[model samples]
Target: MASTEFDFIIVGGGLSGLVLATRLTEDPDIKVLVIEAGNDLTSDPRVNVPAMWPQLQGTTSDWSFKTVPQKGMGGRMLEVPQGRMLGGSAALNGLNFVVSSKDNIDAWGADLGNGPGWNWEGLSKAFRKAYSLTTSGNIEKEGPVQVTIPEEDTKWPQVWRETFAGLEYDPTGNDDPFSGKNLGAVMRTRSFAGNAYFAQARSRSNLTLWTTTVVEKLVLEPSSTRVTATGVQYTKDSSETKTVNAGREVILTAGTFGSPKLLELSGIGEADLLKSLNIEPVIDNPHVGENLQNHPVCVLSFETDPANEEGFETLDKLTRQDPATLAAAMDAYSQKQRGPLSKTNCNAMAHVPLPGISTEEGKADLARLLNSTSTAAEKGKTPSAFAKKHEAFVHSILTNPRKASDGPDGRFAPPPSVSGDSGGHFTIGVMLSHPLSRGSCHLANTRGELAIDPNHLGHSLDVEILARHVQFLESVLVKSEPLASHIKTKRCAPRPEMGISDANEAKRFVRETAIGASHYTGTCSMMPRELGGVVDPALRVYGCGNLRVCDASIIPLMPRGNPMATVYGVAERAAEIIIAGL
Candidate 1:
């Protein structure tokens, strides 16, 4: 409350917030303020080091929000960990700098009516402007984020690419994931916002960042035509409550769960639900917290032969805490900033079209499944404009020969365990890129607690597609050469004795073991207001004049591969949009 006013007030000082602040403050005349709910752990090794990401969850940095029991997963609660620091979830995510497919982004403009700027051609430039590739002999030292594919000494990547190539898929189709498609066992980058965006601009005089401050609600001014956001009411240090005003606009980067929860808390949600919570109603939009989506992943772990260090020397050695290996890795990292510790063991991955889509039998099965699901939706009265449009977008990708619907990512490391029994493992995680299932997030009460229901695997279509992907892996990919020669016949995750007999067994396996990719989006989607969209093409909230959401929550559809690069690209593009308006 130093000046009691600023050009812009950002609710969350996470990834997008920092990017906007850094870019906006480039003009020395403009000032920006960022309020973060969690403290700045920029100096902590858990945030800086690439390998220590798994330990950040359940710590002070993670929000650690648990979803309501998912009926799709047999009434089990899944932990949805969101980063709560200055860098946000980017500080606590698996370092995979992947971009969305071109076809997926193109649909946002063509099918979804998001207009021209939201299309692939427009977004691709934004993606390039955000981060520069810093690989061997191809260094770009300009962009804010330094993205690098850590050099690997093992042959895991070669075997991984060759395995998929053996199945008649091109292993180099997506050598440059920035080209819009992520369809190959290419090595993605390991970069985070902490070491890049925030670190570069933290010392700016025009930018003020307040950590450990929670935003209560937006300060809105009501008029006959529209609602205007002037500022925000917040509690700092869990003590005195205060209000601040914004001179220009107020942006909500509170993330997927937090963004919608704040909107609902501030009375910008369904009128009945707001009134039920003893809160005054401002907007009657019921879609404020709807359209929640996530990429549900089914993991398949296999035991690898450890005798060949050329192919099997993975981070599993680090997981097992081998003293000699640990010492060597530390020495290499500290001395040259290169080693197994420099990046994750999940270096090889592929985003492929639905498994078996080339065969006539597979085409028939897919057609029958799609028709049945469509009929079910019609009978259940679930055919909203948004629903129909989304189904069509997914349909285009699933049936197209070039578009990808399933992502199979390979990890050379074993799952972490405290018993010290995890070792010599290779895991293939098949993630459903475009899930047909939809969910919601809302405030539980007036005091401000969120009831998040990701509703993962709620739709049978998601289950069916994921099951087929798993079946394809066990029957086709793992049995091929190079990769097959490096692994044993035993399974590490689902015991060796647990053999699948048919598609029914695969579906059951998916229902039991599927977990969220932690890439939650679409709570506050960007589409037409009539189509239950919370924001317009300009990313302005429908009923608010100066309020906008610039985080992952604004993503209309779940993108292929990881959403980290897309988030950065969106923020960069958003900064451009906001600046151009001025």
Candidate 2:
């Protein structure tokens, strides 16, 4: 029963936890303690190498969990990997840094009735506050993080740019709210400093980050209805149980899975479920482990001849960029903190609308169809019948862009139609950013450890949306002349049944082989108490006084792009709220 105290006790040492801890400790008078359930980043090479992310997929640095059998995915379980290191998932994810859609943020604010601050204007400030931009290729700050865009000597950047241009999307300023359409340039928001990972930015002077410490419970004060999270009980390296006391608060930043499990283990979840586990309910918050949402992503890989890989070959070489070349780039960055490497990888993203959209309505008619179970019913027919109907539908959607009726900034114009007959081979990676299906995260046992049940592809519509995306890829393969030349064969899971050119067959193929984007969120949602909200507008749990959740779990809906930047932005804002409250 040894006890240690701090002015602020932050759980989990990932991006959110670290950001809050770092900000809190900035004031020398305050003490911040960060307890992590994973290893430190100082010696982890997998975290440092920008090109090694795919290899780290299921490693020890990842909390490699799987979902329950998805009914829409032909009853198959899918891998869900979360970062288990000090930097959290940011340490092991595709380094595509793009701000989420402003529409998504507005929806979140509307849902919470929080007004403008929760909208884009408020979030934009937070994004700038946390990150010091150095685009145009430079590393101005000697901070612990370094972001560089992938080198442009490669063909990938050019091809990506052309594709977006072909779609008629504005290529610059996609990351900035004030910037116009046509956002180009890959965001260089990675933590790479030279050839190594930058761990210092997340590391702080007063923040004591204790890795390999798995929190098992939150000890609350006995008398007050307000949750005085006095301390936490955790297992050290999964071998020993230990308790550490917090003089003031216990903030849970253990991510979607770990955070909710902590709440449940502390008896703060659904009463019936806790009662089933023979644990008495403390807070009776049914939403503690509900509302799980993640991006469902499907990649279409193209195998091209090494000789045809001329332009793209630059990417391979860039991965092996020599010290001299890197040094020169570094010098350029040092001078101005702006260079090619300082930009983001994705240049543009299009929000295509389905048919029957109105320019002034702002309502997403296509999203409705994508979210409709009827689409699934249409796609779920036997393979032969589906392919017959799917092909034409796919072609129409790809060549004709749908504009969101009633977009916040007025309706975006329809994308330029690619020559329906043009040819070239390219893979279309379809990602569903905002999914409606919800799941849950609970403790595996009485001891507090996360049992992540993502329920991936839980709803029929999720599968339908992915199916539509796949159809779009197929259309590109068959319709475009240049794209068609590069395509040797269609490669992916549940390989299309031989000679099964029907729409039904394609639908079946998509249903059987779809995968996830690994962006799990919303297990501990921030909403009003009436809507099964786990935390309030300030991210504090409804019944708990001093405890707060400042990670992706607080996001009520999945954003329309990569979530890392948003996660960082949210953490920054949460830090401000926490500080203001104190």
Candidate 3:
């Protein structure tokens, strides 16, 4: 292998990695190299078009990981698709832009001891510094990356505005901290220019982005005490093996799954797990692959009569409605980056406190569940209480007519059931913002292939919380005046097949079907090494000087919303840290 060195070696060219590399390279004196395992997607049409994302699944651009048989999922393996392109998962993601709660930032400071610098104010500044807002009035450009609202004004946007207004919620600025009330129209923010995906802003003069380069392992010094990172050994075009070096530092931005697996292969995980793989141990840290977390989501899809588009139609509607209309719309979008392809399909999202559930309550409940004395009974009690309270709050919120109003164009209808079939649709998805259950990533064999065992639905508390979320949705459909007309009370599988009607049944349903939102985090966590953390608060892997990790993997906990903004912010902040240290 030819040996070439640089000031910094960043593995993974995803959003986070690119941000770090681009920001660092702004100082022309420093050399930065970014190695990506996937191909360059600068002009990939599927990635550029907003609505074409769903079609990206099962494609080569996705890592397409399958979780090990989940005990909580009736021993079923679930498909977990992660982006493997230059922009990383962001290139293939749904392109939702939402920031975390202020409380979430405070919790991170309190839990990880990263100081107030990592708080909301600090993170917000970083967010502004990383993204360039394209919207006019109040929302000004803040960073290098451009952001804009979708051009296609679909019915979903109006629906979201009306629904939030009915709920007495107000649409505030994009960075406003979320409280239980005042839920409003979710402003659409994405990496788009006019109608196409935006990737040009991140391409910098000094940043060297290497595509289709998979990092094999982190080479260490003989002492194993001082890790030079040396260079990354990788497979190019999936045919040849080569090694490239970092003259000063190696930053692991290979994302959650890829980062931890690289660490393990380099003998930096739990001593026992490494021994199992017949690799010599460099560090006996048990937490390297531990504490894996993700946001689990359950989708709701409805069959709406086509006033907007017509893919599915009854014989009667087909005879009456214009079939050529939708085809023409699709064709138009494909050619000009306008029309339906510009729409994200999801216009808005609501964040509720679920009644008596507050940030403090969740923290305490999580601690007790994680370290409870009574296993079965205590597990049953806390979550049950939490669920009941949450469901009650949801019921009250939805049933109240004030909570069902939307902006103009019927954006918000009473939770589907109440809206009846006015050519409308509803989907009540419950997402666990922060989960207590954690899993790990390690080497399955020595051949370099990785294994990700998230152990999703492993925690009884997670099941309890998710179950309550579902029950709350059900209560809204049944009790809310606005939602009653649209309520299709057909209980689906796992819940109905098992004949589960009570709290237990709801919990079982959550356990069996809750899927990851693909927000995988905390594998190579950042904290003081004494607390079982791999990287320090500065994101440098402890005991390994000149080595750092700049990605979501370093985030100790999953925030309360989409992580894209946060990931970009972290990378921006990290570049400053690395530069200052230099």
lDDT for each candidate structure: 0.81, 0.60, 0.62
> Of models 1 and 2, which has the larger TM-score?
1
| TM, every model | 0.95, 0.78, 0.80
Clashes of each: 0, 57, 28
RMSD of each: 2.3, 8.7, 7.1
lDDT of 3 by residue, 1-582 (tens): 356677888888888787777667768888878888888765666776665665677888898888877776677777888888877777777776666666556555444567666877777677667655544344555565556555424444444445445655554434322222222221322362212212433455556767877888888774734655687788877767778888888988888888888888888877888898898988777778666777766443333334434332221221223467556656767577565546554445666544223346644654464354222343321233322322333333323333321111111222323333333344455676556556777678988666677778766656765666666655442334433433344433223344334678777677666677788887887765655478876888877777788888887766656677678778877877787888
Worst 10 residues of 3 by lDDT: 404-413
Write candidate 1's Cα lDDT for 1-582 as tens digits. Answer: 554799999999888898888889888888889999998888787776777677889988899999999999999899999999988998888777778878778876546778888898888888887876655567765577776654667788779888888877876632455766442211322356766787767788888889999999998889988888999999987787789899999999999988988898888998999999998999888888888889999887887876665646767768877899999988987887677777766778787889878889878889998988872354221237777887888888888757788888888877543225654778888899899888888899988778888889888889998988888888878889878888875566753445554888888888888899999988898888777688888789988968999999988787876777888888998999999998
lDDT of 1: 0.81
Best prediction by lDDT = 1
| TM-score of decoy 2 | 0.78
Please give the ranking of all candidate structures by lDDT, highest first, separated by commas.
1, 3, 2
lDDT of 1 at 493: 76
Off by over 4 Å in 1: 1-3, 181-190, 307-310, 375-383, 417-419, 495-497
* Candidate 2 Cα lDDT to native: 0.60
